[model samples]
Target: MIVDDEQPAIELLEKYVSMLPNLEVVATSYSAIEASEILKKESVDLLFLDIQMPLLTGLDFLKNSKNLPKVILTTAYREYAIEGYDLDIVDYLLKPISFERFFKAVQRYYQNSDRKNIISESVPERNHIYVNVNKKNHKVNFDSILYIESLKDYIRIHTSTKSLVVRMNIGSILQELPGSQFVRVHRSYIVSKNKITAYTSTDIEIGTIEIPIGQTYKEIVEDLCRS
Candidate 1:
């Protein structure tokens, strides 16, 4: 989902795709109108949208779209930073985007994504989940998990015996775990309720290990304690 009017800009983004092995480009468009058409046909998890384009600007397109995915704005101009953040965009990458900067922006997406999911609090629960890695899926029992950690577009499920990294987001993974058994305590962490032996305003204890509760998630920690 790279929507830039310039061919070279799009090519640069495509070139970086190899670095993100799990990334899949469903469609690429040179204009907001074309991108809108593609969105109607496919479900995109993330979008790298350009601000300057013909007909409809990237910001205008996003404002009109009913269902928006996690967006990272790629532009040469820096004037739109405040407006971009106001729309809750993942990150704002200045043009001629560097790999290091790109990866950092992506990491920010992972963090904000987990935070958004926790606030939504509508993920359906399940008792078990499948962890797919390198084309094979492994069934994992929820009760065995100590916690789940965010890995950008991936999630690392840490259990009593072993830790497995799957090419999936924590938001989607959280839905697969029983809500009663798992709790998203931080933007980067989801702790198993069964594994927590102690907790405070800022952190939760799972055995001897402690997981920090995100500042934005203070209400969650407080509400859970009251319940």
Candidate 2:
């Protein structure tokens, strides 16, 4: 699915997507509302959405949808990139998108989708897990965490305002967080999309601190941006 008010942009995307092997441009709409209607009646695996559209923007469409597919935000402005990532979009493409950038975004989605499937298969059925922090048992909400940082043998949990330190491995803590919201961006850092302030290829800024992005976790971070 592709939603954009500009015919040229839609045509360009349609042409580019057609060249891909396992992808298809299912639908195109000038308005978000029209796109919503189509989505309600059909199954769409991916959405190429324009952020600035009449009647409703791409963000508005995402908020209103009951079932969301992988979304790639297409916009003229770069300012919305952070917000788009916060919303867990698949990728952010600047206006006048080139074929190379578009292909990169699609490839990202495929990789992420494959990884998610593997994770989901291995996940146990549970809502929450216990974490021992500072010799006290702290019941952490899976969705409330912003990020986690490893400091020697202790791991710091950054919530909306509060921070808790627990003596545990970062990998152990990551297992407790919901896979959909939390992602490891560095060897020492795991971030929650709901609490991320901003991010780049090098770092993810959460609240007042900037967490480094490890080379091993770059693909995961990019996947997080597209989520």
Candidate 3:
């Protein structure tokens, strides 16, 4: 079963699932509410759930539901890896999800389901990240990012010399970034820690650009102050 609010995402996932000979897509839901209701009467083996949704989130729904199946979380956010793993999910996939990454996630799920002896890691290594824009993959170096800004349903990856606007959320792209270099200062902003020239309780200055710090991200600011 696949549960995502975006119809395009659902279609893309369905296309991918069809390629797997051993896998079959049972159902697809656009809302978590619909998925939750379906679960009450359906016996699903695996689930591809989205994180951000109206009314209820995928994480909360999974926690509240009974007889939960093997879940591979498909979301636009990467920050939820620790929390999702704490709930014992099979995998956490970031949005604009590539075929390679998607395949690897499913393979991990299959290995775990069959009780294979293999060590699994939640996040993958990256010296560069490939962003899908205009149906093309743009490769950006890890060291080039100044900051990331969320623009409604899109995100702008501001590099040292250029910027790439991807149809993805800020939370989703943060996964591909080098955590040591990048830090989430606000809900809509993520800055390259190394590029930060100045900062205060409310905002940070990266070169000439000023990015605000969210109220909930005060602890992150405190951590930076201590460091």
Candidate 4:
């Protein structure tokens, strides 16, 4: 789904989406009202929305949707970023979007949906979780993290590119992370699938660093490896 008043923007986005595999443009609209009508009759997995539109803005359209699809906001204004994040959008893309950035945003949406399905299938008991560290609250990108390890009272978060230290219990941190991509491999350690490099019975290596695997968590680790 693509929505924009500007014909060129819609055309460019359509071209970009067409280049990707397994993605089809279900619909495109110049106004929110027209989009609403189309949405009423069809199901869309992704929406490329423009923020500034006459009558009903993209933000308003999203808020009014009964079943909202993953949205990527496209606009010339950068000020709407905070609002977009507040709405829990997949990504915020500025006007004249680069091919690389557009691809990354689409990739993020796919990854999020994939992990969500895995978690929903595996654990139906949990709803939401939170983790606090260094006096600053950090919401974990469940699919983006590789694992975590306890350092005294604090925990070190190892992602694909960087490691961050947060002051909190490992248990609390695990709750905030997405369960599909993360598992408690050891009492002190949590690892993300994308970050895992190597593993053995007693230890797991992420990149160049090795974390000890607790005796109790060995079975969990083995299960993950087999899966």
Q: Give the local distance difference test score of model 3.
A: 0.79
**Backbone clash count, each prediction separately:** 0, 3, 3, 6
TM-score of each: 0.52, 0.54, 0.52, 0.53
**What's the TM for model 2?**
0.54
Off by over 4 Å in 3: 115-227
Number of the top lDDT candidate: 3
Error of 4 at 224 (Å): 16
Clashing pairs in 4: 146-191, 146-192, 147-190, 147-191, 147-192, 148-190
Screening candidate 2 with a backbone cut-off below 3 angstroms (N, C-alpha, C), the clashing residue pairs are 88-227, 89-226, 90-226
| lDDT for each residue of candidate 1 in 35-105, tens digit (9 for 90 to 100) | 98898998988899999999999999888888878998999976665466546576777788987666656
Q: Which regions in candidate 1 have their CA more than 4 angstroms from the true location?
A: 114-227
lDDT of 3 by residue, 92-205 (tens): 788889876777677667755755534333345567988898999999998888988989778999999899999876756765555556777777888888888988888889
Q: What do the candidate models score in CA lDDT, each in turn?
A: 0.78, 0.76, 0.79, 0.74
What is the C-alpha lDDT profile of model 2 across 1-227, one tens digit per residue? 99999999999999987877567877889999898889888889999999998879888777777778899999997656545665767777887787766776675676567444221212133455567865778777776677888876678887765888887756446534555567778767888877788888898887787989988668877877776
Kindly list the per-residue Cα lDDT of model 4 for residues 1-227, writing each as its tens digit.
99999999999999988877667999999999999899888889998999999999998988777787888899987656545655667777787887766765675577657544221211232333345555766655555576677786677876566667877666545434444566666667778765678888888888788878877668768777777
Q: What is the C-alpha RMSD of each candidate to the true structure, in Å?
A: 12.7, 15.5, 8.8, 12.5
Which segments of model 2 are wrong by more than 4 Å? Answer: 115-227
